[model samples]
Target chain A: MKTTAALSRLFAGIQADLDLVDKTFQERATSGLDILNTASMHAISSPGKRLRTALTLLSGKLNTYRFQKLLLLSVAFEMTHLATLIHDDIIDEASTRRGHPTVNALWGDKISILLGDYYFAKTAGLIADIEDPRIDHLFSDTVATVCEGTILEIMTSGNADLSQETYFEKIKNKTACLFAACSKGGAIISGASPEEIERLHAYGQHLGIAFQIIDDILDYTQDQSTIGKPAGNDLRQGMVTLPLIYALEDESQNGYRQQVQSLLTQTTHKEEDITAIVGWVTRGNGVKKSLLDAHAHGNKAREALYHFPPSPDRDVLDELIDFVLSRNK
Target chain B: MKTTAALSRLFAGIQADLDLVDKTFQERATSGLDILNTASMHAISSPGKRLRTALTLLSGKLNTYRFQKLLLLSVAFEMTHLATLIHDDIIDEASTRRGHPTVNALWGDKISILLGDYYFAKTAGLIADIEDPRIDHLFSDTVATVCEGTILEIMTSGNADLSQETYFEKIKNKTACLFAACSKGGAIISGASPEEIERLHAYGQHLGIAFQIIDDILDYTQDQSTIGKPAGNDLRQGMVTLPLIYALEDESQNGYRQQVQSLLTQTTHKEEDITAIVGWVTRGNGVKKSLLDAHAHGNKAREALYHFPPSPDRDVLDELIDFVLSRNK
Candidate 1:
């Protein structure tokens, strides 16, 4: 309810454009085969934040809003995002996202793999039609970074000794890069100056960092009903995210640190242990410190929007930072 | 030895360029991360037919033969092929290919998925550098078709009643499209005339169909040591390939057809039954009939090349049809 209200408020200016992005995505994503159509429809019909699309549109609105180009770009970005999620669920062995069954859960891993690849192929087709070399490079390069970031995260999975800098690096590649591409690509299409494009890119990168940090925090702080998946999934999957990193680094939480250390180093995780660590991180100033970092990034995102003159789109872009920080799911 | 000799004879003209493609594929496919680099190295070090690379280069040779552009295109095509194989191995639950362990066999499906995506990302980066909308569209569109083809195959996977037309459709999309892209993309880069481009594209399409049919044929006739994987894997996996389809449709082999039908349509496949079917396919008219179809497609590919005047590269391309048809593994 809170997220819906916030999205309605945030996307009020661009709802029609967002709807077009959604529609174009659905039509383009379908393969016209029964199983693929049904599976893709299920994945596409799910409610997503559409933050990337909003950023692209709002960024374009700041200048000459090229609806057609921006629409294609937004659809490409969101489709790419969906493709990654489908593949990530396979990697995460996740059954659900946002209270809905994942493509992997419903169709099995083989179909999920092909479906993800199909989306990626569709995304490439869309990117090809855009015809802008710069945008093309941005989209493809960002996807590569995202893949590398995922590899980095998997490599560091269960490593309790992961540094703060490494966590930042992982999130930057995995999440922030796509956000950067969205804003940067939008700006490019809208004829924004190089300096403005840089600013929007920065805005998106910081916003994405804040977004992922809050997501990590919510894993420790929110429940399945609220966050739409079980809490502490990161820990359950042996993922060492922001809150756990903070908790591990905090000398003040030495007792909880040992508990998390064992949990992280153990060959296998137990349900009760994951629950207990989620409790410890929630109470041991980990979430509090992570929130501070999230706020810092949020502030950085806000600063990126300062160059643009005061406008409705600008205001929405500004409010998006708060939404990123505050959203439960 | 025969295969190596054939490759040497066929690639004598373009061995330097082909060598450069190998060197470049190695450098670009690397992520500089240890695990990915190691896994990618393992995949790269294994000997692949590199027929796609040869097709791209030889196609270019027919015209301007832009060395650098063709090199990039070849690498991208091969990498795309590699990425698909990585993912396909996961879907097929394949333990090995060509006497080497698969990425999935070594690192598990999660790593294989990321590695495949990483290769795909790398391919995109290379494609972006090419700066041609036509090439970009071709690469992406071919990949999409390939994914669709794979999905089509999976959907038809246990259906004993699948039609020959549908089988043709699946292989065309899955295999021939990529081949067509390579040849046609090479022609486009070389500034081949539209008519020449279409001819080369048709040549590739027919050639790929012949190649895949032979592959399907080998699955029944070749032993594990000879083929690098066990024979009858298609039957084991419930995949109805050309030979199986042929055997089923052959009215003269009614007794064998019933046995094969029971094996295919049954809830579970047994080892002995699979062995029995492989023997039946070898003895029945299925292999002979499938071979005739392969030859028919091979002749069409040869006819498509009739437009090109005789040259060493043309001859090599011509011999490639024979090589593809006659190779034991």
Candidate 2:
């Protein structure tokens, strides 16, 4: 398990390129409209881990590095992720993200919806500027998949009947698919062969699944301040994530399934009820089982990395898998 | 002004191709998921006037008509329009559009948001399939401009002090830009000369402005049964459109401006208050003034069309300008 400092240092090889991506991201977010510029600037001010950006840069390095094209691709993917998050916050009615007020919380749903859309438009423009048909197709299909994944999540909300297969499907659509695109897109722009592109794509998919599983687990185990959101937030929203799915399947836990069903169907979740469910999931082997599944994915991601010769960028990606597994938030 | 039957006959030459566009639109709306397919199908089912489709087809006809490429472009533009309408309903909190329940009204805002995004993704994928960089840039820029226009409209919603220049800017961004893209896209695909493309772009832009001006006018003058939505609908939402703008500017109207100012600042608009304001605007030169402005743009559109040699498609486009000016709904 890497410490936060160690995790931050993992990307030392691509740190400069990642910094350039951040700069480009901020520049791309600027708009001619005062309100749009301000809101968009605020939206990108609190940056994420930039894991996708790193994946893109690192994957590009695996073949022939095209720094300029990779930078634009990285920015586009990051913008796409940001757009989805703004819209997601609207659906979740989340007031804050990463300890900062959400666009939805600050500007209202209408503004947030427009801002998310603005980011999407900006992303499309950037992809078009890249002018690669394959990248264009990959990006378009990935975004569509992300939307489908979100739709699937909304449709399956409150169903304790959600299966492991369906859970995998949802995460793949919502999270892993974009990760795959980042890697594959990087590979394509760097002129990597098709087989190599597929390998990186596989690598990103497994890493993304591991990342989302950890996120779901942290939702149960972490407190509000740590995760920057309420614990059991997904459960409160009636989202049947992997841990809850496993927890409910454990019939040995004294009618716990009925408790979950009741909680899922509740009109409004009381805080204590959410706490109790979180405890049940954590106390049972749900978090541990989810962790094991994440580790299995992490191993697959590592195996994908082994297909390429060892390089500094590959080491950072390998360490990223560990970071995904071990991070508390 | 052409009769309804005559207007329907305007696109007779391209009717078969337009039918194919509708078929493509329907096929593209389908998804593997039942809920998405159902919601998306419903969204596209209540089709608005396919004026954009006609613009694309007619512009293509002015050059070497590439029906296949133009068909895809038309469908993409139509889907883009559908996607915007779905999101617009969310912002407006609108229940019915085109005498049918909006996706936002039936499926809720969350699903509607995702479905809109799914359509956008589908649009992007279709554009990528066309593999034309110029088209790619045009489509991306057009979508972004639409978002900017929508944001501008929301920002200026309650401000009765919004300038006519700004109003023109808003409509151009929100409506005319896409129309320009439709015509320009058609011309580009059909291998039109640069000068011819510019003329078509200009034609579409002016026509779109005229079209939206008529739409705004209809919102003020038409009834719920006529327009499929309530009259003064924009004003109810605090949208200061052309007629209202002109009425507010009419200082000689003996305190009518005060009535409008007071109404604009009201927290909740009463039905009768809206009706009274509508009557004031109609009685004054507001609607008439707005109609003159529509005609001015309509003339400019006609001028752009006259640059091209007389052809069957060109004649249909010429009638289309009259259709834009005279349409009640």
Candidate 3:
């Protein structure tokens, strides 16, 4: 009951931080043009965890450098995250996101793409406004790293032979790198010591890995309503996440392999096929095992923060670590 | 004869500078990955005037900064330009660029999109390497403005009611802002005075506007072999460029507007319609008048540079002004 209450409190705090970032996004994109205004608002108003912004703010606070620059930097990271999401939807051919029709689904691919570009540009502009050379370099480098990671993901998609090492690298580039950047950049902007910056970066890296692993596990475990899309969608797309990796471990399961291959060969997948695979993965304990691994990562992430000065902010950071490993939503 | 010789000399110098930028682009993108090497080489091997890089180098030279920073900055701007072109081809559904199959046409839209992203990230990396706050800010601002301009263009497409003022603003953002940034940033990096930076920026602005106006005119007048794309293709897509703007001046040409409407109404466009419109626009001297306007703007661009001290580099700058206005191929 105490842990539940703590989780609730953490959720509320994150919600408030995200709301502030959304408000800032609104003010910055207030062009008089109607289409621009509508598109900008629609894109920003979507539900997101704002995890990147949280990492930025928490890291800055933990380093004892909470300031306007940190907030601006946080906003920049969130904008980049949002921009990438918008573009990713188009690339993934996803019809829905966050329990709503995607921007491409609503307005067509062209506007979705151009609007994504606009946000990327806006993010860069925001970072430019921060005006510290070290921060500027870090932000640009992070943006570049994120893009490279995305490209790596695109390259490896649907390749069944993709190794675990490459998958880790891809995830590091696509997801964890930005999280790492958020923490590292926040520390740099706040003028944290080099040691503190390194610690925060490590913390963010492990947290991101754990966060993505949980996401992959949830795809096979969560309800469709909670997942915001169909179950086993990633597997359908031939994205072999950790649970699938575990499922593929038994070379003697020829029947299972045949069933999976048959589904892969189908022109259009049926829900029953997806459900069967989900059931098999669940019965095999793949999901539960993956979750345990995620917890291990989360623990390591918290351990990385041990060198930081003890404070409430640090405590909140620890809570965040726990939240990643425990959250169901 | 003297004028022709002067023009030839200027062209030769510009070509040499373009070769240098191309070589630099090739060197920086030499990743061991075969796909990266192939894509980078394919993009850089295409023939372009390298106007943005030239502007960067020339402006830096004008301000007497003989450092490697300008070269790196020039490469960064050119990479960004190429990245946008890759994305633009996808957005425009263009099959050819520079008389060769576009990246999207040669590979696929998916690959093209990823490649464009790779270059965008690469440019950001280059900027980070420069490690200068002011240049970083300028580059980031230029990128944002370009994206905003692109969004505006997408929103206004096929809308005949779009005002000329809005069109100018869009072009200025999409095209002229980067050009202006190149000159202003180059001068600033070279430690030029405020007045000199402003003068160079004005020069870039006027030159960019004139450059685009000529480009728009060529879309109506030039042969496919020369312009490397079908003439009147923009009009076929319902884009209102300067020549089309002037052609629509007479109310009696309501028929022309109706023809445009009819063309757009079709499920598929016929080449005959494109050919007919191209003929009409050419005979009407719309292209000639547009070129004359380009010349007027080019003269204004030259005037902006009059405030600077007289040097041989200034002569080269003056020559470039006339060259951009008169170039046919």
Candidate 4:
């Protein structure tokens, strides 16, 4: 896996462009109303990885798309991400995001909810000028998919009935779809040809799958402080992600299946049990197998990019797949 | 003011057209998922005045725009209204809407919140096909404005310092904006000329302001059984609407402002106090002044339409103004 220093150097070429994204994001979040304006600023000011905007900027650079249009598209994608993050925090009952107090934590859920909607409105407003039918539906449909995916996850929470296939489906909806939209939407707006667009779509899909798997793996592998969230948060919330799903498969073949099943199917969890399960999942080959699976998706993402000529932008995208896969400790 | 029966007769010509709207609304509400599809259906099925749809259809008839496009635009307005309604119910903690269980009441706030987002996504999906930049920004900005307005209301909720001007400003952002959008959007999609569009915009603005004034007036004047919501709801929630703003003026002149000011400033309310405040506001002709103010706006709406030739659609638009005024009783 690439080191942090390597990843930073890979993106250094786009640092100037990313700074533009930061400025645009902050500028667009201004609402003119004091409270809303402040909340909007605060929501965007959080240090997001800017992954979606990076994907968008990188994709646009693949072709000779208008720089101005690409900037707008990048802003739209970032705002869309921020919008959902607010709602996601509310659902997770999370008090902090990126080590900062969440909008929900600081202002409460009512403001968080509306602030999220405001961000979405800002996203749509940014894209409204794009005037592409494909770009138009791509965003709203992605939102619907993300919301549906989260709802499905909530409904399936604590169910021992969760399958590996369902786990992939859930992550695809909840996380990967937006990434796919970010890649495909940038290409579409950038005037990428049909085949190129399709290839980029696949690249985004595979990259997103790998990204989410690594996220799930991080839940078990990373310690509390570095991850900025409690380890095994998914388990405490009764959510079964990839690591536990693989762990359960291993446990089921042995004698510990029912023990894990009882813990999962229970409506609530004791903290110690959560800790034990996190440990058990890590001790098993669950984390190992998950990383391997993520690597497989990463390879697919690389393969999808083979048709595009190797430019700096394409190289960064290629490195990003590795960067996402290597994010875990 | 026109009687309810007279208003119904005025709309008879568009009865067939409205039936088509009902059909389209139902057809569009269907998602493949059981929960969302059912929730969508439930959200729309509760009988509404369908006033926004009516405005769109009637506005379309004044111009030569395609009926099909008008249908899409009208449905967009209704869905936008429905989307905000779901979120509004969450903020209000409302249990029932129009005598039917609210989405928040039937589903938890989590579902309600996502369901609201789903509806918004649906609304955007519908309008993404419109290809008009004006309509696109209109829906999104109206959404932002509505959310901002609600946040402002919440921030100022127990503050006795709210002014009459501020109350109007709040309602304009929260309620009048959507109504104005319905009018202007319909005209824009229907290909109305710039001048005519401005006229229709004014008509909608005045109509919406009048509509909201009457709505606030009804909260004090109507019975719980008739309104399907508790009377004095705004007061119980510590919101100072136009009626109270006007009543405060009357009370101040009579040296009773401090008593009412203390009640308004309270965060929580006893049932009897809510009842007493409701009576106090009514006794001072707050409801009467509010209705008169609504009528003045209604007259302005009528005056805005003076240039349009007499047709069934135009006549209905005019009488609809009176119907909204008479709805208080």
Model 2 residue B75 CA deviation in Å = 1.0
lDDT accuracy of residue B54 in candidate 4:
82
Kindly list the per-residue Cα lDDT of model 1 for residues A251-292, writing each as its tens digit: 867777667767876767788988888888888878999999
Error (Å) of candidate 1 at residue B182 is 1.1
lDDT of 1 by residue, B1-329 (tens): 66777788788888888999999999898775789989989988777548999999999989998999999999999999999999999998989988999999999998899898888878887898898988988988898899999999888888778899999999999999999899999999999999999999999999999999999999999999888889998888878998888887788776775576667666677788888889888887889999999999999999999899999889888999998899888
Could you arrange the candidates by DockQ from highest to lowest?
Answer: 2, 4, 1, 3
CAPRI quality band, candidate 4: medium
Per-candidate clash tally: 0, 0, 0, 0
lDDT (0 to 1) per candidate: 0.89, 0.88, 0.76, 0.82
lDDT of 4 by residue, A116-142 (tens): 888888888888877787888988898
TM-score of chain A of 1: 0.97
- Lowest lDDT 10-mer window, candidate 3 chain A? A1-10
- Scored against the native two-chain complex, candidate 4 gets a DockQ of 0.75
What's the distance in Å from true for residue B172, model 3? 1.7
After superposition, the stretches of candidate 2 with alpha carbons farther than 4 Å from their true spots are A1-4, B1-4
> For chain B alone, what TM-score does every candidate structure achieve against the true structure?
0.97, 0.97, 0.92, 0.93
Q: Score residue A317 of candidate 1 by CA lDDT.
A: 92
Stretches of candidate 4 exceeding 4 Å from the true structure: A1-7, A252-269, B1-8, B252-268
User: lDDT of model 4 at residue B165?
Assistant: 84
**What does candidate 3's lDDT look like per residue over B1-329, in tens digits?**
44345555765655666566677888877653466678778877776536788788778887766557887888889888888888888888889886988888976776677677667666766776676777777877787788778878877777656666887888889898988998887898888989888999999988998888888887887778777887777867667777766666656666787676566545467889978877767777567767787888788889988888788778888888887787775
If the candidates were sorted by their TM-score against the true structure, best first, what order would they fall in? 2, 1, 4, 3
Q: DockQ of all candidates, in order?
A: 0.73, 0.81, 0.49, 0.75
For model 4, residues B166-234, the per-residue Cα lDDT tens digits are: 888888888888888888887787788998888888898899999999999989988777877889888
